[model samples]
Target chain A: MSPTREEIAKLASSPAHEARLLCRHNLVDTTSGLAGDYVQANLVILPSAYADDFRMLCARNPVPCPILGATPVGNPKRIIPDACISSDKDDFDIRTDFPCYHVFSTIESDGKKKVIIEKKTNLLNDWTDDHIGFLIGCSFSFEQALSQRGLRLCHQEDNKVVAMYQTKIPLLPAGIFHGSGFVVSMRTFQPEEVELVRDITRPYLAAHGEPVAWGWDGAQSIGVEDINKVNYGDAQTIREGEIPVFWGCGVTPQFAVEKALERDAIKGTVMSHQPGRMLVTDWKIVDFLKYTQEQLGLSR
Target chain B: MSPTREEIAKLASSPAHEARLLCRHNLVDTTSGLAGDYVQANLVILPSAYADDFRMLCARNPVPCPILGATPVGNPKRIIPDACISSDKDDFDIRTDFPCYHVFSTIESDGKKKVIIEKKTNLLNDWTDDHIGFLIGCSFSFEQALSQRGLRLCHQEDNKVVAMYQTKIPLLPAGIFHGSGFVVSMRTFQPEEVELVRDITRPYLAAHGEPVAWGWDGAQSIGVEDINKVNYGDAQTIREGEIPVFWGCGVTPQFAVEKALERDAIKGTVMSHQPGRMLVTDWKIVDFLKYTQEQLGLSR
Candidate 1:
């Protein structure tokens, strides 16, 4: 029998074990709220031919695509040992860690380019020696941090994906990865909670950091035309006194990949973890704090 | 008549004016103590073929080589308009702004590859359409900050170049720019003032940040074999009750360039600003503080 939601939550306390359970059961749902306190990452796997440009892309658009770790070409193991797990019985595998994978392929149909997305349990048959994997920071890390401070996330309470939208702000272009604008995810909070939310999220620099914009007025500053209409994820109703807060979203890279395909800049297949299905790593929320401490030379 | 030191100091209060004066008179002396409160940079110009690898090198080894700005290929003007010069000049020529430049050439002799350094007033004849300029952060910015807080740098008092040493700590490799180790500049301070010094310098992330290691034992931790055998600059005596603190030095990238040439990873000339002849930028010391403020979302 499959594990219950409560059992999954309990198993999530141990990220490695939780990832194993999800992989073994081949669960296709989102990984949100599963591995509490541990770092969950958005995965992007590309052919080695496009690796350098994609690395530059992440470096140029750090806010939306903060790279936590990258594997060498043809390597499937995590950069850090046991950072991601496939199953309880097998070694950590990038192909099967996440609940589902989205494989994107560009095809020529009727003298026009069309993108086809295929959902698969793993990339076992699709894996190649020339593939490289990039694990990027997810805003879920900071969302958990905000929740700990008593700032309730409306989407989690309502059991829906956070609303995401494309913005007018253009990302700094690098190499062939150009022309794609910034994408953001939105949440609503009481007006009084904005400062506290910013304070709580700013420390997680690897995870998109603080809100790019707050309130409807601030949203328009970044050229968000409508709060109800979103480019990705489910839109939630804004309460009477709640303000709309926007943050750099992990979905931005997927959009950039699509843009690259449109321009014929990328020729091979590009793979990403399904929107809510993330690769759970061994890193804790406090690891970012530790990095800051080390940077400041406070720790031995 | 030549301007007095006081006149030059006063003139340096404005970076643009100082740059023009330096360019016109060809003042090839150390720029230290001239431009107070302004940021100084180490300049490196390479051919377009090697620009991407060099950029990756800077990204991978940020501590030793924090990039302040990079000019687009074939562009001699600063990346930010009027950011690096005083408009009071006849030209915004990068070739003649500093005291001197070091042009490195690779030569093969006796079945061994060797590097020859040539000192030039500018790269006037050497400038080409394929050259890209990289301005790296210099420690002088934070050193000035430390001086403001009553930390006396001994070498500055004696009018000598700061002592520098090459270490066994290998830098994170990027493409052809690999195999070079870290180089550090050492400063001595009384044991009681170590923490305060660390605290003051930690905020200047762009200018090498805090000390990588402190004291005699700490120096050994990073693989400094001997203190007396200096690699690049003048060595100062360690007074009783004083501890030696080491910080990342800008000289590292120059050393890396030489290493690259030795292995033939780099072809063609590599140009760099002569030691102590830095490119003064229009940025204030406090600009870095503002960056931190913005990163933390405290200034929004």
Candidate 2:
């Protein structure tokens, strides 16, 4: 069930620590519209053996797989504070922070490898010392930025998921992780406002930056077969004179991981956040940008 | 001795593939002024045991350690092409291509640990499968950009090494790598031209971005106690009305590795490119920026 506008506003204004408690206790079903000013990150946890290759994959495809930071080998506790959502909370555990998780694995049946997914509320039981948790930048950060600029998001207004599609755009292959293309989230903007939207969103490079494609031709260029049907998330209303705009999605790595598992490239379980549900962080979008610019040498 | 002006111009116009050949055959002692239109990189090699930690350290302090790309584990050949200087050459060997290298190690003497640096022309004998080669962005890329904008570099004109100093600015520590600050490369510009220089260099985020500090007070703020006495490279002439402008140097990781060795953080030999000698590559600075923008989500 979607929250009332008043409730949404209340959630948006809540401190990150309080919002985390709600999610940690399973009181919140989804992180959307919650802690609106705070940075929300997509979470991916991988075993130590595959960590380096995964890091390289993220490096290779930074738009879809922008890395916020990761845990050290065998350590579930995040030592680096800036990359983390909660800078002041030393006890923030990746295993129990997010609202939900999707665990992916592969099994052999009739001499064919098949992928399987299991959903969970937390990761306390599934985690191990060999696992490293990585936080990836989410479009929610830019969505918030866009919202502040008076650009209305139809999905948010109607209480639906941001439409996502698996495009034919091939990702740069990394070790044991290949054969997956980009997964882009779709939004709609009028033709006249498209350039303005691009200008506003381009600064959030860590949050997937500007739109990759827009308009009917843009959608076709990326090879989106059906506009109404989405691979993940729910489709939103498309007003007349408005065109669908696509931004690189965080679900990209998840799809890549699934592909790797199907190819038997990953030997162990891979965990990721359920779409739309994220780990709300203490960092604001502007502050995170400053952190990246000063510490990571990435400036607008 | 430095090359003559005609020789410098000829070297600058030479193709990256030819420049690499010159270095590979030991025909060139330094990469400076060679393949001026191409990208040059600083190399760092570490055992797999320490690569992840070192990678994290680089991530934590990116201005001083911007990663262009890295060789896969146990692979001496750089598989990633776009990050390579010779993007068209698949056989860009890390062990043999660089003009010079500095091998860092530790030894215990009189009950105290001491760090030692050894100079080598190649890594044929020292390299093993356990090593991972990382290509870090060098200041040379941005220096070329500055030169193109009519901002003359004193060191380049006089054929002197860019003066570098160890600064007191602390770096964020990672596993088994800590206790080191930043190393900055200094150039001089007139007081009125400092802002213009900053505007020019800011776009080269991979090449240490804009100046971290400028002017006499800027140098003092970063803890350059004696500007004339440089810690590495030659000190160039500081003309009247010109102020020292500092950018994060590639030597930073070298200093960090030395500090780690002193603290017994690293167990095996570490390798890096010698100051002033770089690995020339096929990528031009403008094209490299576009690659980062498209692939790495870093746009100017």
Candidate 3:
């Protein structure tokens, strides 16, 4: 059964408790709207061999892959003070934090390597000593920030997943991770509200920050062929006087992995949390904004 | 002979003429005071074979090696409209534009690779089709902004080169670019005036933006020991009521190259403009600020 808003708000208030419930009992299938005050992260796990290249990919394409933190090789436990809940718990395991994980393996088939995706509840059995994990910033924190400012999100109102599309924007190639196009998530807003939405979300640099582009025809500029059909997630209808705003999506790294597998640049497995089943962290939204402000030299 | 402030101011008012004077005629060796309004760049030239790795290094270490523009492989000319001066003239060549160039070669000695620096007028005879040029943003633009805001720079007032030091802060490693320490340029200011200087210079992100550290203890935080000595340039005295402020220096890439050569990551030659001698580009200081503001989503 779907939890009520009050239940979600209670969970949001105590992220550590919520994480225990989700990780231990598998109480939630999707992390959306739960722990709204804290930062939720997208997960990407790979063998240590590809860690350097992946790091380069994240550094080069920061907008799409703003890394909150990364675990050292072979370390399943992440300990970032005030940034992650896992740091507080001794038994915190990345392999089972999320409700579901999508394990992708690069297999040689028909003279070419192909990536095959398999859904798993947890990676406890699949975890290896050579694996490294990366926790990337997600749009959830910024969405909560928007809601706090009274901005209406169409996806939440409609009870559907946010619309995601793969755009023609070429990501800056780094190392063996190249040639994959950029991906973006769309949120439609009234024409008059677009600027305000941008202003509110601009400070969350770790959470993909501000909208990359906005307008009725914004998707076309980034090479989105049709709004009705999305590469991932559900598509929302554009009402009268509504414009679609696009922000760099966390799903970008997954696409890059697929592209890398195709090019034989990556030969091992790549795993990630299922869409919307993010790793809820202990970090407050304000912390990220403060860090971004300081890094940009906006704060004294 | 060092040009006087009046002569440099006259040249600063006309960058195209100044560039011609510097390129065609044997003019001033240091480009510090010339072209105050325009952006000055530090030049790094390398073979196309190392272009990808070098680009990755710059992207990974943006504050230390903020790239303004890069020429295509084998292209001696850089034509970035309104971003660089080389675009304005057909004869503008990266090989001869600067007053002096430091050509570095990686040579094997005692079974270890060592980098040797040689000063030259131009790479006209050494220029090859396989070489690529990178024009990096220098702190000159932000220094001008600080001056415009009535901030007094100790190095400028004393007519000494900006004091530079190699900090223990290790740069984020990219492919073939690891273990190199970060480098910073220092300027001393009165304790009360430091905040104003940071506020004025923070907008120029293309140039090294803001002071990374300040005060006598600032250097130690980033891993530099002893303020009395420096790695490069002239040392300035920290006054009784003043504190030292350090910003990321352009010399970082050269240090990285040396490190890479030591590790045998780079087997080819690396060339750069001599310290204080820079490429005076056509881009205005305001343009860089606007670009930075836009990139950070600070503007509409």
> Best candidate per lDDT, number?
2
Per-model DockQ against the true two-chain complex: 0.02, 0.03, 0.02
Q: What is the TM-score of each candidate against the true structure?
A: 0.54, 0.53, 0.54
Number of the top-ranking candidate, with DockQ as the measure: 2
In model 2, the runs with Cα more than 4 Å from the true position are A1-300, B1-14, B79-91, B293-300
**TM-score quality measure for candidate 3:** 0.54
Query: Which ranges of candidate 3 are over 4 A from the true structure?
Result: A3-300, B1-17, B80-83
Residue B11 CA displacement from its true place in model 1, Å: 8.2
Q: What is the per-residue lDDT of model 1 for residues A1-300, given as tens digits with 9 covering 90 to 100?
A: 987656865766465566645754676366667666777788888888876566655654566788888766787755533443323424467887778888998888887777788988888888788888888888887777787778888888888877888875555344456557678888899999987887677556677766766787778766788888888778887778998988777878887888888777886778988776777777777877577445422212
Give candidate 1's error at residue B18 in angstroms.
Answer: 1.4
Q: Which ten residues in a row have the lowest lDDT in candidate 3 chain B?
A: B79-88
Candidate 3: tens digits of C-alpha lDDT, residues B43-100 = 8888778765566566546767888887767878754442476344555788888888
The CA lDDT at A46 in model 2 is 89
Weakest 10 consecutive residues, lDDT, candidate 3 chain A?
Answer: A79-88
DockQ-wise, the better of 1 and 2 is 2
* TM-score of model 1 vs. true structure: 0.54
Backbone clashes in candidate 2 total 4
